[model samples]
Target: MTDQQRAKPLRALVYGDVDLNIIDGSAIWAQSMTQGLAAAGCEVTLLLKAPVTTDRLVAPLDGAPGVTLRRPYEEKLLSDLGPRGLTPDQAVTLMTRLDAEERFDLVVVRGRRLASIAAQFEALAGRLWTYLTDVPQNVAEMTSTAVSELTDIAVASRFLLCQTEELRCFLESAVPAACGKSVLFPPVVVVPEGVSGPGAPSERLRLVYTGKFAPRWNTLEMTELPAALDKRGVAAELHMIGDKIHRDSPEWAKRMAKALEGTPDVRWHGGKPRAEALRLSAECDIGLSWRAPEMDASLELSTKVLELGALGLPVVLNRTPMHEDLLGPDYPLFADGDVDAVADTLTLAADPGIYGEAAERCRAAAARFTLEKAAERLRGYLDLAHPTAPAGTDPQRPLKVVIAGHDLKFFTRLADHLMSLPGLEVRLDEWDGLRDHDQYRSRELAAWADVVICEWCGPNALFYSQHKRPGQRLVVRLHRFELYAEWPRKLDIDKVDAIICVSPHYASLTRELASWPADKVVTLPNWVDDRQLDRPKLPGAEFTLGMIGIAPSRKRLDRGLEVLAELRRRDPRYTLAVKSKQPWDYWWIWNRPEEREYYERVYRTVQRDPLLAGGVVFDPFGPDVATWLRRVGFMLSTSDDESFHLAPAECAASGGVPAVLSWPGADTIYSRRWLHDDTAAMADAIHGIVSEDRFDAARLAAKAEITGNYALERVCSLWTDLIVDGTVPEPVDLQGAIAA
Candidate 1:
């Protein structure tokens, strides 16, 4: 066989985790990308983490001229950082060896670590493209000296684009030669469902989207898609691929089962190597992507779209231009903020002729940006030498973002958000312990740290058991989950400089739970990117009530469904929407006993709950939550517990009369003196707010504006000011105080 026909492995690394590869691995973007790369005659080596010797780790790529994998021993940044993360000496040595060897034709970096890029791209440009899965973050952190070191490699190395607008920008920038039309390809891992003929045909259009399970993704809101699909008597199946972490632990296997209970036609796949996911995706039709979770460019499409194409499935996509760019001309556009529009479009898509035609177009479009195309393009770039050569470590160090082990999403995401500011850097270290913190290292991290930001939730401060001097300023923002961690005593009361919270109740709860001196905690509300919020409300949008949450204990999906049933029974002009990230297959759940039990319990609770017999419906996910809320005349939050109702806050901002279900439990910290669990109060609030259309519209706009204050710009500024400014205030009643 010619080299064209000779099978080659396409070495790929996911950097971290995503759902696509969790089950049938195809749910991951890289899985598909790698599969495509392998199919095009490239060998693929995937780096993955697993508890044991990898459960069914080996996978396959079909009909392609290549190979695929799930390597369990691949080196992660932490291991290379140092033996125990003390110095970069080990990392420097590892990068030196990896780059000098240059085994892979291309090195696709997932989340950006400037040090990693500096090590690889600068010294190893001849071998790979600086492929970005997440948006780049360490540019600002590259010290002047670091910049000079990277300048040589960056100048010579090829650049990969993770965003469409950024690709457009690069086209107009000085580095156009370094990156050519930075088109995106999903991470390759093909799983042909391993199911061909004679398989039992399901009644529903099995729609699945698998990947990381996070809050801001608003993935839960996606349930609305199923609701829409259900209207045409089309039974629909939704599957969220990937493991979800419960609390701060990485044991995500059964994490999401709590929230996805009682919902019909949905399932969860525990975790799988990449290639397997593709095979699983093949049996199904339709995939989903809406970057409603955050604005960081890294969240752009990687593989989900391609899997859809590989299956000849049309995607139900978000309006983001990034995904749109990938869709090219093949995507059928849906109005930005209309569930009905989505319903209309999808209903039409369900038609085999209509969807198949569009799917074919998408397939043709997919070919344009497939792994074959991308690898070839990258090959052309790597053949050219770097504009600049490698230098030593940077002198003027980049702004160090001291990431404590807390709020991985918020911190990393915020870092990505903050990195957009002219000059900044982000770094994550495992040494940030409150009580057992190494005296010497903590001092170094803090001393070197330009900004020390801590998430509200995290692991034991036992690591900080050997506390030391505190130099850099600290900014702590609390998410709802942190309040539940066991030992509250180990929290670094003195090390913290700024206490931050996403909601007022979150702030209050921080004070009540941690009992950190009142002066130590402050509230800085959470904000979605400005781009994510501007979707226009749908005209004549009514009858859409959305309840989004992955956990039933806190989010209260059943209660919301109950309320919707009541309302819908009173007037048939009502639709209920629920979104979640659970797998959609019975066998998939049967494999995971913890998750299986979780679903069983939730199902029993919901099915047996007299109030919600036939009321609640599921949507796609939360990305278009505002759109979903606009469809509802009244929004209800009947949660038994909450850190702060993010969806309600968003719904309130969307002008939906948010009916917060008041229940008396741990009310002092999060709920304040508001009516807790009074059904009459819920009705009264809903009644009072629903009638004032004009006022509600203004409130919606105002809520958007008020919420906008929490945007990246504002949040980053809050972080920047706290980090750069010397003098700081202790936490106080931010209830009436103005925030940046």
Candidate 2:
């Protein structure tokens, strides 16, 4: 080590998908590096990338103690990749930032994009380590070659990414300077950290498979194993848990169904959550990893293996270095990847003598992979990187609230801050694919819920109709979703506890509905601090007129166009910008001539003919939404009926004047009383509101005042103390009974 470099605290930056649903050994490895490095004594920070839609904000990740986390979007990682994965350049940019932020002693990059990200870090030389989580024969050659240039470091490639070629290049390329440790291979998790005590068994002897249906590991054949075990007097069943990349085609399920035909003990149960996948993995007496033959297939280790190992279950698999490395002394190797071998393993599993030893071995290994072990390893790495530890404390106290909604991200900026509020607990019902029955026959999950908060759609109505108890509180968030959908009307207005709208105007609209009482509903605007509101706009602010929301029928795509027309009339150089790359229901709107015509006419008459503005401009999911908000000197909203208007306020918060259209039910207060004559007059008002600079600062200040009303602490406090607990406050006006 260089004397000068050694004196400074070494800092290790770890990256991975830390999402609750983000399972797999790679995630565990990164989590370990994050925690272990911190415990191992380095100044460590963990960086995570968003796996869901870029515009949507997912929930907060409860990070490792004393570690910082971030979701860095090099936009290119999204929009461009047609679901295949991240591009080389996006990966490079992501890695470059991590490397650039203070000469990191070690930069640990895991999963997916290994090429350009690694190459850029390697370009920095001696400062980072490439912890490739795949075997030599599993990942693609190009990726391995790129990662090799960075370091030999560590290859815990149990749940490998890519294919054979990348695997070889990564394993063979030698760089002792990267790391001195031998390959840890894939971490064999016996008991994953944070799993609630063990899952109590239901009536079924539930056996489950965790990975997607791939040629590399086809456990469909193992469906026969349970049948074989059942014949041997072992009553058990099989469950599959994944979106199986091939689910789009009926042929895949048909093939899987065929594989399970004669397997009596095995019934295709269904898929589950990653955490549930782990719990199911633990519950089963045995876990299966059936890999089909491919060039690099034999070299692969299954994610289910580590999950099973963590749960202390015996695994029956094809002979692979992955299984061999993880199984250790309790190795159960099957030479052929055939059903017969699987059946034989099941038969042997029925005879506890054959599988008990392996299960015990798994039990011994489980402790090493607990969250504690990873935390320790993280401490070591971080201690070496950044010798002196920074202060360890969360200045903002957290709220303990539960999240109850169907498969929504369940996490957003507002929710994140709410979740971080003091004395709040959070839990979300992320499983939303259900049938929408009659109003009374809503979702079954509603009965167990404390609060019902959702972004309503056709399917969302199921949640709304589920009869809520008088004690239950239902808060319907009125974002931009109310436009052009049957959901708003379908929502049962009677069961609500408190009506919190993102905009006061939106709250006012609730009053006009006559269906809801005015006192029960209040305004709670989406707010951001001035510091976050004032970031640099994208290049050439004047030419860019940013409209970040979509939903053609109502999102004011037309209003944006009208404002652009007015600006162009005033100045020719101005251009309008929108963050919608495709039309809502693109197959319906962007495809059909009628839908397209309706969309075009709405924009041209209201917007396009006047100013050439409004189309899809993918949002740069950056530090703050205000960054994009500031791009336009103006923002506009022209919707027919809005429970609450969010984008306009965010625009105002971003230091821009938000000029809005006052339609029939724009917000309950805005009727003929709040507006002029007709649509033409509304359009004229929008033009005047945006074209003049006089309204800018004052409107932004007004926005700041409104958002402060919906501050995380206030919202969370209401939910925790009043809403969930049903602590209805003594109202000044008792005439209006609250409904969910």
Candidate number of the best TM-score: 1
| Residue-by-residue lDDT tens digits, candidate 1, 266-326 | 6666555544555566567766655452443444444656655665656676665455555
Scored by CA lDDT, what does every candidate get?
Answer: 0.49, 0.49
lDDT of 2 by residue, 49-83 (tens): 54443221122224545576554443342455434
TM-score of each: 0.41, 0.41
Candidate 2 residue-wise lDDT at 306: 56
The CA lDDT at 697 in model 2 is 44
Model 2 per-residue lDDT at 646:
52
RMSD per candidate (Å) reads 20.8, 26.1
lDDT of candidate model 2 versus the reference: 0.49
lDDT minimum window of 10 residues, candidate 2? 731-740
